[model samples]
Target: MMETSKGNTSPLKVQLVYTTNIQDPNVYSEVQEQRESPAPPKTSAAAQLDELMAHLSEMQATVAVKADISKRHLPDKQDHEASLDSMLGGLEQELQDLGIATVPKGHCASCRKPIAGKMIHALGQSWHPEHFVCTHCKEEIGPSPFFERSGLAYCPKDYHQLFSPRCAYCAAPILDKVLTAMNQTWHPEHFFCSHCGEVFGEEGFHEKDKKPYCRKDFLAMFSPKCGGCNLPVLENYLSAMDNVWHPECFVCGDCFSSFSTGSFFELDGRPFCELHYHHRRGTLCYGCGQPITGRCISAMGHRFHPEHFVCAFCLTQLSKGIFREQNDKTYCQSCFNKLFSL
Candidate 1:
């Protein structure tokens, strides 16, 4: 019997204890006494304690789960923070290159636009923080607050012109050149022929010899391509207003002789007509690299290949001797002293 708080029962009652028969009179009497005392019985103590322990375990488990969730989310937060730092570092370098004396506070100087948080360039030299000016321009310098983004300081004027000296390449007294940035300069006449080092004044295409270089050179000298013609001359290419010659094409522009038919050579950066350039290896005296083939000297005398050495004093044929090894300048002992005296 439990008491009802609905104004319908007494405060003291025996809950879960009923009077069956008059079997256990002593037990019945004890229940009645406990109802009078209005307290729980001794047998119910362990049950109440067990219920409390169950509630405590549930609370502990809930807290442990919450802690685990926080631990899992921490690394994601750290990664986001790292990405922000990297972005900021890159912007700082750009600001330095612009030669900005100070960091802009709000609006852009050149475009006169509001700078958003994401698009705000740290490189600008003019900006406004307190006022919403549609344009950023230099006014009277007021005693206002300033800040340095990288090494640059800013107040309110355009400081892009305060950077460095002009570029040496295209900064000319003439008006044809254009300066893209304060540093990058270029001339308007840069697209002419790269071979003759000639500034092509007209718009006509030109070619010479069999190695077509230019029309001017072909008529002046005998025209014909090199022994190794049109082969994307990697070492050099054709050049010449006097005649057609590969940049690497060492055919004589005067004699129509091939000089470097299958070898390497620097483009002479000059006008080489077809008949003048000569490239002859077998006929050339290997000693001084002069022609001696059909004229007389055998290829195997105290024969010095172009790559061999000869003594200046006695004309002694010297192999790769100790003294000849350096630049292969083979000098007899006497010639060495005579040359070194100077």
Candidate 2:
């Protein structure tokens, strides 16, 4: 007879031993012994054995249930006889006949629950059909295209609104190729002149007032106008009279000649050479009928060259403020008193 010890136990204990018959090993007899303890047995040995057997049966049933569930979760083995389609068609029904339920193939990415029915595979994860929804709108994304950002799924409309670059002109999302200029974004077709609305070419564009423009419109609308030609002064321009003029356009308004001496006089908001400027304002000498560019004498209501101011009677040259006037003519003081001493 072989005896086995059950490690450690409480002070009060009942030891149960079962020995197999030598002739028939399957037949067994039970021997019960009560050890020295502070407490007596509460019930008979037969009743305690019955309770233990019932508990063992319950544990065994629980283990069987868990094993069945594990078996159903395992990956399916390759079927040599039937194709995949046939096996899938009858597999659920066959399991149901065996009183076993079908298990979920995957868990939903959104709700983190088993996907027993239709499943949506998106963004490298599986999801229940109803649970696969846009993060912003919370609307279902079943069978439709989606966008992914920051490990989250979104519908097409929300994705474009939230993430796509917007056109600076139209204020709409730039779904296609983007043209970035003027520190803003725009669609390729919408990146045009703000004034003319004509599209820009590879020559590039200009910016003004926080908007973009083609070369033609930019110069026409923003560049200063030439003072002479009254047209846009694109380059090589000069600023005069608070206006800009191209080098070729800066000419005399009257004679249409350029200032050879790099100097000009202004008349009525226009530039002119010294000769034409004096003539325009009637500042020329009455004797020579030429522009008096230097100091001149005013007598008889007409400007005169210094030597041209002479006496009407003796033809003597007169000094300024010492000359006398009579009958709209100029004369010296001595000649005036000699001719007509009144």
Candidate 3:
């Protein structure tokens, strides 16, 4: 009546050998002869039980006949007759008890036949020693570990082959630990960076093309290069002028200094500080030789700040495009007409 758990794979050992009383007169002599001449090991316990049951059946009939004869012959011997009757009754009861106890415990779950000796107790059922077989191959799963799914037993090899999750990279069954990522299952060791072929650590990983990659390889292969430093931007980047730049890499083109005001001017698609941008564009004021950030006047083929553009004779501010150029010096209409009129 022993039951093994689903996880337990140890073989269930049941001793089916039954012993009879040696004090019985008829069986005592035969048992003595058996002890004197030992039987071979090849004689199975079931075979021995069958032989003993046959002998007991024969002895039961002989004792019945002997009791009948004693009842008729020893009617005058009361004391001896009572003792003999009690002994015969006790022996008969013992034999009946032995027959009941020797019956098989339960039917085999596989074959639906009574399991006699060495029954296997597994999956909350009894099975014959050879009947406890894998449901798939029908081969005996004797003593070895097995997997049970949906009330069916399977050997270790077949179970893993049929049901275990497969590794996405190696395409092999994952027997022990399974690592799941990117909608695929894998073995822990097989779940490595596709670029470097090394296992991922605490830094974790990145997914590209449905494969895992380390941070360094992923950035190098996929991340955009910085517009200033010309290196891959890992994170925290600025997007301007259709180019990406790492926060530290977004610097002025000439001075290589980061923008303090977070403002930049672009020339030929490159960012520069205000001073450098105006200098590069040749837009510096002619009078002050500095960049003109506000409105400026262009006269005498040179750009001049509005306040700096003056009439040469009157020293007053000349309007934009309303001055006369003479000797490479600018003058207003009235001043030019009055000073140089002939």
Residues 1-342, candidate 3: write the lDDT tens digits.
432222213322334332232221111101112133454454455465556657778877878777777677664777556757575566646655555333456888987866555656666677775887887888887555678887787887888889889998889889889998898998898888898999999999999877789998998899898987788987698999898998887888899888899898999888899889998887888877889988887766688888888888897887556887788888899999998879
Lowest lDDT 10-residue stretch of candidate 3: 24-33
lDDT by residue for model 1 over 80-175, one digit each (tens)?
445444444444454344321223234555456443322212232333333312122444222232323344444323332333223344343333
Q: lDDT (0-100) at residue 319 of candidate 2?
A: 60
lDDT of 2 by residue, 1-342 (tens): 222122221221224333223221111222345466564565565455455446546755665565566556556554322333344445546434533345565787876765555556666667776887888999987756677787787888998999989988889998879988888898888877888889988888898878888899888888888887778877688888898888888899888899889999999998998888988888888777888877788866688777777787887877655887788777788888888787
How does candidate 3 score on lDDT? 0.73
Residue 61 of candidate 1: its Cα lDDT? Answer: 68
What is the Cα-based lDDT of residue 39 in candidate 1? Answer: 43
lDDT for model 2: 0.70
What lDDT would each prediction earn against the true structure?
0.39, 0.70, 0.73
Q: Candidate 2: where are CA atoms >4 Å away?
A: 1-104, 110-118, 293-295, 310-342
* Runs off by more than 4 Å, candidate 3: 1-102, 234-237, 293-301, 306-342
**332 Cα displacement, candidate 2 (Å):** 9.3
